[model samples]
Target: MTIRAAHFTPEVLLEAPRRSEATPNSKGSLALFSVSTYSFSEHKRQSELRVLDISRNESKLVTDSEDASNPKFLDDNLITVLESKDGATNVLIGDVNDFKKTNYTAGTIDGSVDDWKIKDVGKGKYLIAIAASTQPDGTLYNSEKAKKPVTTGRIYNSTFVRHWDTWVTANKNSIWVGTLSKDSKTSKFALGHFENKLKDSGLESPIPPFGGAGDFDITDTNLAFVAKDPKLNPAFNTKQNLYVIKLDNGSSPKKIDIPGFEGATSNPNFSPDGKKLAFLSMVQNGYEADKNQIFLLDVEQSDPPKGLFTTPDNKGTWDRSPSSITWSNDQKNLYVTAEENARVKLFSIPLAANSTNSSFPKAVFDEGSVASTTFLDSGLFISSSSLIDNSAYHLVPSSGAPKLLSSSSRSGSSFGLSRSQVSEIHFPGAKPGTTIQAWLIKPSFFDDSKKYPLAYLVHGGPQGAWEDSWSTRWNPAVFAEQGYVVVTPNPTGSTGFGQELTDAIGGEWGGLPYQDLVNGFDYVEKNLSYVDTDRAVALGASYGGYMMNWIQGNDLGRKFKALVTHDGVFSIPGQLGTEEIYFPNREFGGPFWENKDAWNKWDPAQKTENWATPHLIIHSEKDFRLTIAEGLAAFNVLQEKGVESQFLTFPDENHWVLKPENSLLWHTVVLDFINRKVGLKAYSEQSETAKALKESALSG
Candidate 1:
């Protein structure tokens, strides 16, 4: 199949097949993945399951039903998938060659399941674990008829009244454990009664909003999971603890304690033998962005399995924070993904028991951001993406270079884009001897003699760095296609660089990081002759949104012709509406009252006298993280001050515009706003932007 060359616009990006992380089968000879794409002609999204043959480098459709998802290998030739049956989730078993040809029900659950796992114990019995919502009585909670008060009013005596977009209720996201056995009479797998692992513990496993299968892991006889501490206030604490329980016995969970560590713990990984457990740990309390260190535990499979704490024998302290952990096939080494120099790279760490000579992890794969990885007998299966590429699967052998297996796009030429169009620039930072990196994307049709307007995008997580990855939201390629020189800087506080740089932004919201961005913009304007800063427009969301407001009130505001802030903070003192109070508490040294001076110093509301730029304010009604009030307040100030500004609100969206239709609208309006301010054609009006840009390209 060939994809026609076209402009990488929002509509095109939305329509592009969104692929999930590919899971390799037990033999590693085949992989399973699902793809979802929005169909403009059908006016709905379509989903399908596909099987990829590793050796042949070919793919075949397994099922095209929208209800089919989460395909996994029950064995080499058999596969297990979950499908919706009468509003409840049920597992189905089928042959890999033709799933529907021999499909049959393997097990059924009473309610909706977010994630499910199966581990073969022995004989005909298997351990089944699922993460789902449960009521106070430890019963599966059905979301369709979720228990809610009849009254319209909501009362809250405790904090966490709401998280992200949903209000806190009696129902908790918990893990359920059960047994599945095969009956010789019918030769069918039957699901036994499931018991809530967190029952009466007052804790939620796989914490809401983002947690899924990664929150917990199960072995044949034991289970491990991460849960927020019940003793602390959920609103202002980041103290998620690790717990382990026996799967065969009705036993209570045992919390693993780290004497000096008070921060959060996550990503519990058990060795192949299930005797050693590894998890990532942060040392600082309330600070969620701290460097994560790998902590090992020795598990003795006694009656109640005793867990003894163990630490890595270090030659030195590592600076990078690992996002995920995976044990080696031999359990002699560990592979992890961590950010380094604006890229998520794979690192290998040698594991030794009670040894004090283990060196730091070494980088194995250093190109592109690795989204997910699976262990293979011959090598590692990596799914990664970059600025010009949507998704690509590669097999990195232990001794050789990575071999590309498949890519979401047929080729770069098929999309009218190439890796050459993207480059990185490093400039001097605000502090002496410091440097910052940024990604620079040129238009598809580029001429070295012609200058293009600048689109400066600041990333949200103040701690988050601009990675060399593809994103449907805030895509630099989309902006570059609009005839702009897009430069995204990784200023101070950006992650993947080092812990020092990441922790530098605390209490200095508008200080060194702002200067780093200013210096980056300055470098682009003065050093890059093809970029025209005179018609530049800056945009950001979340903390990046906050930076736009900060720039609006500082000297940097005069550098850009226009600014866009999405769910940004207008006033530090007016942030009580946010559900995560711990964010400000750690960033500002304490709560508002305790650190009034520090909060006031960086408050954009205090410098409203300097507001004089054309701005676009985008906020969502359900943005409980920064709250909608913050956006409204910024717009009000801009309006009252006679600044040229427009307000765009999505009543149905949360912090992000996720719905396909809503995302398209967001991109359209954002492009229109920036284009209009920079004297470029509107997105809807110019359907030939790609062709025009292509014609302007320099000869290869």
Candidate 2:
């Protein structure tokens, strides 16, 4: 059964890093970044929010709020921010020095705040707001208490929680935020345009098909604005489209339609003079339109979006999606980065007046790593650990390729035994000759003489790599901090190596590659003296879930103590026709009706009778990929056979929990479950864990 790439549980695609930050200041300068761990429990990506000094590579800790987000760097002293803990939102103003220490809570008057923002009316006066949690219509507000609040962005403290409309930026008083759009399930529009207005939980909010239907940004001609709608239902791509809105005072939005590009447009930036807008689009998907482009949109013309270079020139019609496009001071060229091979490949576009699409985009430099592009004055900024320096960068004008910038890295910080660090351990991989380079993070203050318990980490992406990234939710740090020896092996079919390694599992489901993972675990036991072979658990999401199913079907062993699958696929056949996304269809190349055996053998459902692992299934309600039913099917099978298992589904989260509060809460539950099942003392519930949570709240 062919599955659309989107439907493959998304664990692999998710492994690739995602980035977000406020717009650059007047001089195109942003030397510092306020980052937080905004991620879901289902994937293995970096998670944490902190103010990183771009120049020094230093960081100031923010509250451990899963929803710690909406940061505006107004000057250097003051910053406007939104913090949500429980179900309310709190907007605050602070000098950069004491921003972390400021009192933050939801609501404007008192008690918990519901919503907020910082508005500067261009002059000198600044306006801050605290709105009611309930929308105008009277339904519950978009918070923890709502029906299902999607953990949209930031890691607000554990108590803070917001719905899909978690973050937004606009001109202080006018409230014209050209970049963000707040849409609800009932077709409600918070940022002017909404297609499907979802029911509001708090008061009453306006339904979509909102006030600004086609475009926004109606005030400055110099500023180019375009809003792309990913459709009322993001899980399905067919409903999505792109729109370009020119921000001129009193000018209505222009819904420019690109003839061939079907998917949504992402991260559109403009030239210094605002004469041109550069953006990227996924174009078409099912067949072979993985290439994204750095299209040049003429703000002077009508629907004049020009497709530049199709990336990887050799691969089908691949496109290098230019993300975070920025113009250099000289205006002689544009500094941008394109995403390639799951990581970002940096590039440059010249502003030569006489050059065509072929001449302007001259290849200059590429890190060939998973880095998110940003800018800091003359140089470009990137957020990635893939580089040798962990947090290094490139200085555009003076650089050759890209230099590692991080001078000092606080490599030693633990959340107790719940989060640990294990470096430089190698294991045997799928085949005997292949070496599985890995890391085994153990509990803090671990007793080496004694054999400690071990929790196996199954990375989600079949093509994804197991890299070192930080997170408080389902964090490897948690296991090490909590005292368990967590094993993460980059078995065969993992990325970071190349596409050959990634495509290894493309057509093979329950074949040798899957066995390679099991073998990798065995290799760890046989090689690493630090790992306790006796205690182990099979854990993963997406395709990793597929492996877990394979293990259960084969009745591998009683060696595994517990199993966890987050947004995984249980039945390939069922997933093809049923999933919200068409990923299975695309991957497998056809419907299950045409290829029955391939569907059966490739599916973990067929081997249900041989299941044995004590499994835990986590399903994100907003996950557009492998629907919740797939997880439920696994639960039913495990339960019917009397196999020990539990299922926890987050009704308010998406494929990934992009909020801090929920992330903290999520990590808490997962760690607690693992600790309890693994025969570890539940001391964390009373001491270490509680203290960590509290500290995160106070600091974050």
Candidate 3:
């Protein structure tokens, strides 16, 4: 709750979680999340969530240092996560690569609960957990802790309890449910929830989950669930219960319905010497289209309850549903993760118990439109955004270069896909022949005998595309760790060079992407001879703040210097009444009273008194899309027409910035306003001009 400001202000990025979050520590069908080496664009909402072992993949800051999500294993010698020292949350455990921690418990709880389930029973002598406690209809619930709990309850509510997943359990007193989240919050992906384990703490549904399955996944045998209570999907109401909850230790707990199995179930798994159980049902007779099918069922052949199961028929296809299903620790490789062709892939299926119509096909990894994955022997994990450099990798396969994992390396794109050693310029257009591709990053610490200090940057969906997400409150790694080189250009209405270079920057905002961002500063000063064509600096945010208001009224570049701008909108009809989702009534596909010469030739208030340059801007009134009244009317017309400019604005924070200590106070307010207007610095190398932007710059 403390925010400060000095020079050209707008700083507040402190909320450190930076990459390596892999997440899942509990729940079932194998789950654990910490693969991160740090990528960014906040893991496209935790993509496909698969890679279960890379932190103690054994030891190397595995757990105990603290901060873990839902990490569980138990049978492989225990892991369990969820810690917090003084703030008080509990369930800690150790040794799986959580090197050490014993068992502790106390409580304060009130974070967003993930999932965890154990119930081992026999030998470790039966363990038990279920998760999400706080019941009585609100704070959240689904309890059952075994030795010291007995059974606690609370089904759903608290802005829809993080989706819901317990999967399968059988000890701390019975459990199973589904849909494990598919995007920020979709709520009960499929269906199944039937509880009753009460000793006086919580839980009492007798087949609830909005009365069915919610999203579905029931294969339990702790005494119920062979399959029937299922119903929901009026396009996702999600209720379709499939019974079989028999656990009656001392009374009441029954629901064994299985008539021709009525559909739903998912990724069930067992067959590794546990006697066949394999699952994935779906079916749906055009009934809102669903196809899944892979089923097996042998559960030790006790044929009595109307025994009869065999459908046998499938190659594979799913316009949607069947996003995951694994099993191959000797179960003969099954692996699924499907959504096929239109995004989300990875197939490989082979068990041949009789071989239906065919089963020999193995595709395994796709992510075409990016998002739908898991085939990891160690490299097909997917949670994407580098739509190709717009940044966020973590791919792994041969491990050559895929772990950008994201904490805020932020890219997979507000620009292009991800991957950038940096290079590509090609330009000719407006006559005879045209090519233009323009790209650059050169400063992971570039050093051709050392020169540095550049900073072009520019990307704000002016149709957005720099082939990677370019960061800027001065970030290209805080101007390469306080030195500066940046350069990101995909100009001429960017969008990976497709669809007419993004409908030529829809509404032709600021002419030819403002000459492809001033011809990417003359193609990084004629192919980066080490940069410094005399202290360059232009930066951007939101249509690159309308090309820094069209580069101080078209003088473009003499290699002058300094200029920042975030939340920079300047005034498209005063930014259509402070934006949010309806983006200036469609970001400028029209409006401002139906196009006033494309809003006076893509207006920056038709050139703010020809901008004079030494700019800074950086706003935030929690800008959901673009607002801060166009950087407070260019800081009240650069402090009522004297010009030199400075604005800052941030504090109840927004418009991106989940906090990493306000991203190191937004790189110390754009490197202390480019070290007093384009002097560029941090250490400032005894300013001979900041010793050539600090020895070829680059450090992060």
Cα-based TM-score, every candidate: 0.95, 0.61, 0.26
lDDT of 1 at 482: 83
Winner by TM-score between candidate 3 and candidate 1:
1
* Candidate 3, residue 120: how far the Cα is off, in Å: 26
| CA displacement after TM-score superposition, residue 460 of candidate 2 (Å) | 3.3
lDDT of 1 by residue, 439-548 (tens): 99999899999999999999988889889887888889889988999999999899998888899899899999999999998899789998999999999999999999
Per-residue lDDT tens digits for candidate 2, residues 35-140, read 3222344323343344555455445654445555556555554555566556544444455556567633322221233223333434343333222323344333
Tens digits of per-residue lDDT, candidate 3, 379-482, equal: 54454432222223344353454453432323422222234544455655331344565445554435678887777777675654554322323335445434
**lDDT of candidate 3 at residue 265, scale 0 to 100:** 44
**Poorly placed runs, candidate 1 (over 4 Å):** 145-148, 301-316, 353-357, 687-700
| Model 3: per-residue Cα lDDT at residue 471 | 34
lDDT of 2 at 700: 16
Best lDDT goes to which candidate?
1
lDDT of each: 0.84, 0.51, 0.46
Candidate 1 local distance difference test against the native: 0.84
